[model samples]
Target: MSVQPMLKVERLTKTYAAAHGPLTVLKEVSFALAAGESLAIVGPSGSGKTTLLGLCAGLDQPSTGEVVLAGESLGRLGEDDRARVRNRHVGFVFQNFQLVPTLTALENVLVPLELRGEGGAAAEKDAGELLNRVGLGERFDHYPVQLSGGEQQRVALARAFINRPKILFCDEPTGNLDGDTAAAMANLIFGLNRERGTTLVLVTHDLALAGRCQRMLKLRSGAAIDGEPETLAGAARGR
Candidate 1:
């Protein structure tokens, strides 16, 4: 028998209230990803890539259709239950790094464990190891303000993985970095993802970064195209 996909989205759609009535951001977007697979969503500024990611990650509800993550139907859950599901299986990295400015790197990495009311010695040890793995071993006590953008993003990476999440969602993960820094961050992300066997779904405008994923989904004006251009496909294949 075929294995069930780690994530499934069926006929997903999202709409927002606008002055002229409802503005639909995503329409009938559907896809599936197996465990440990990596997929990238690429699109222009208004193509609804972020919106689609949010819907898939259960951060937002679709106006219609369904999102089933790890065999759990998110569409049927209330906000609290959805949040619980996310906490249990999802990790998120954002463009802004999203670290608590006042918290030390180690502290930030420990937030997820603390949320689950886990603050035992084992949790602390794991948090420290994740930071060290992300090349922030010596920066564990540094606050976000004391770190560079790349460093802060690294801290975010460490934090995201601290919970041992099954799926990771990243939004414009390298948007704020310079080219070299972005490349390095991408390498680290892919490396750690492989190490942990985490399913990765990311929204990015950077074709080079998006190309690194196993599969690419293109969006235009809020609709998914059948396939990407030869150049994009070639880039992905080359990677």
Candidate 2:
């Protein structure tokens, strides 16, 4: 039998009230992500990629439709309850490394555990292991400012994975990195998903990175299009 999807979006739509009238950013968008599957979303600057990510993650409410995460309907939950659910089941990585400057790398990773009321020796041990997995074991005590852009991003990745979330959402994760560093980061992301069986939903414009995912969806004018999987597959075969 087929396993249930970890995330389900049904007729999802988002609209905002503009000066003139209602502006729709997403219209009847729907998709499903099975456990441990990785999917990439690609679109131009104003195509609503970020907006869709936010809605999927329960960080924002949709103007219509429902988002079911791990079998729970996000649209029906209140803000505090939604936040609780996210903490329990979701992890997020942003385009900008959102590490706190004052916290050490290890401390940054540990923050999530603390927020979840998971602390002490076990939390420290797990945080250390996650940082090590991201190739930052030696830089554990370094503050965010003390690290390079790539290093900081690694730290952010570590933090995101600290909870061993069932689903991870990444928005333009490698956007600010150089080509080589971005490639390295992409490898690390895929490696982590493979090892941990974490479902990944990523928004990116990098064709190389998007091609590595199991599937790709392109957004245009607030609607998602089923992209040609062969486009990425051909690129892989050529390489």
Candidate 3:
């Protein structure tokens, strides 16, 4: 039997009420991602990459259409229920690292567990182990400001995986790091995804980063422009 997709986006669209009129940011976007698969959404500056990601991850409501994540229909859930679903099964890493400025690395990694109503020595130990896995063990006490850009991202990655989420959504995860740092961070992300059987869906303008995924979806003018990696690379370059 064929495996079911972990994420399914059907005829998704997002529109905002502009002063002039309704400005649609995403138009009939559709895709399916199987469990443990890695997919990248690549597009130019105004192609609605982030908008699509947010919609797929249930951070935003689609103007029309549906998103089913891990067999749960997101649109059918109330906001609180959707938030519960996300907290239970979704992990995220953002372009800016999004770590709490006041929280130390270990504390930040512990946020997910605490939110789930878990805490104490076991939780602290597990959080520390995750930081160690991300090569930040000794820096657990370091705040975001005390860490380098790459280090901050590493902490974000560790924090993201603390819950052992079924799927991880990343928005421009490597956008803030330098070339070498980005490459290293990519390795850590892909490595963890493989080891944990976590599905990955990321939005990135960096072709090299997108190329590493199993599949690519290119968006043009808020609609998917289905093509191979090279074609998407061309699209990113405006060629």
Candidate 4:
């Protein structure tokens, strides 16, 4: 028998009310990803890539269609139910490195576990090991303000993996970092992702970054176009 997809979205759409009329940001987008597989969404700024990601992650509801994530039908859930499903199965990394400024790196990493009322020696130990694995063992006590941009992102990476999430969603994960720092962060993200066997759904405008995923979904003016990334076409032309 074929395995069920870890995430599946069918005819997903999102619309917002504008002064003129209804503005549709996404229209009938669809895709499915298996467990432990990685997929990239690439699009220009106004193409609604972030909106699609949010819908898929259960952070927001779609105006139409369905999102089945981790075997839970998000469209049928209330806000609390969706949040519960997300907490149990999903992790996120954002461009801004959404760490708590006042909390130490270790505390930040433990937030996910704490939300589930799971804490103590074992949880702390797991958080510590994730920090160490992300090369932030020595900086566990440091606050986000004390760390560089790349360091903060590293802390975010550790935090994302703390709950041993089934899936990870990255939104412009390296957008704020320098070139070398971005490359390093990408390596670390993919490394930890593979190590933990987490499904990855990454959204990035950079073709090179999107190319790293096993499959690529391109969006244009809010339309989904599933295919190989343009980078492959460019490579073929260059050769």
Model 2 lDDT tens row, 1-239: 98888999888889999999999998888888889878888889889899989999999999999999988999899999999888888888898999999999999999888998899999999999988888888998899999999999888898888999999999999999998888888888888887899998889998778888877778898887763322345532322
TM-score of each: 0.95, 0.94, 0.93, 0.94
On residues 1-239, what C-alpha lDDT tens digit does candidate 1 reach at each position?
99998999888888889999999989888888889988989989999998989988898999999999988999889999988888889999999998988899999999988988988899989999988887889998999999999999999998899888999999999999999899988988888888889999989999878888888899998888984322245543443
Better TM-score candidate (1, 2):
1
lDDT of 4 by residue, 1-239 (tens): 98999999899999999999999999899888889878889888999999999999988889999999999999889999998998899999999998999999999999999999999999999999999988888998999989999999999998899888999999999999999999989889888877788999999987788777777889988888753333243321211
lDDT of 2: 0.87
lDDT of 3: 0.89
CA deviation > 4 Å runs, candidate 3: 227-239
Give me the runs in candidate 1 sitting further than 4 Å from their true place. Answer: 227-239
User: Which 10-residue window in model 1 sums to the lowest lDDT?
Assistant: 227-236
Q: What TM-score does prediction 2 earn?
A: 0.94
Give model 1 RMSD, 1 decimal. Answer: 2.1
Cα misplacement distance, residue 116 of candidate 3 (Å): 0.6
- Candidate 3 at 157: error in angstroms? 0.4
Per-residue lDDT value at 152 in model 2: 92
lDDT of each candidate versus the true structure:
0.88, 0.87, 0.89, 0.89
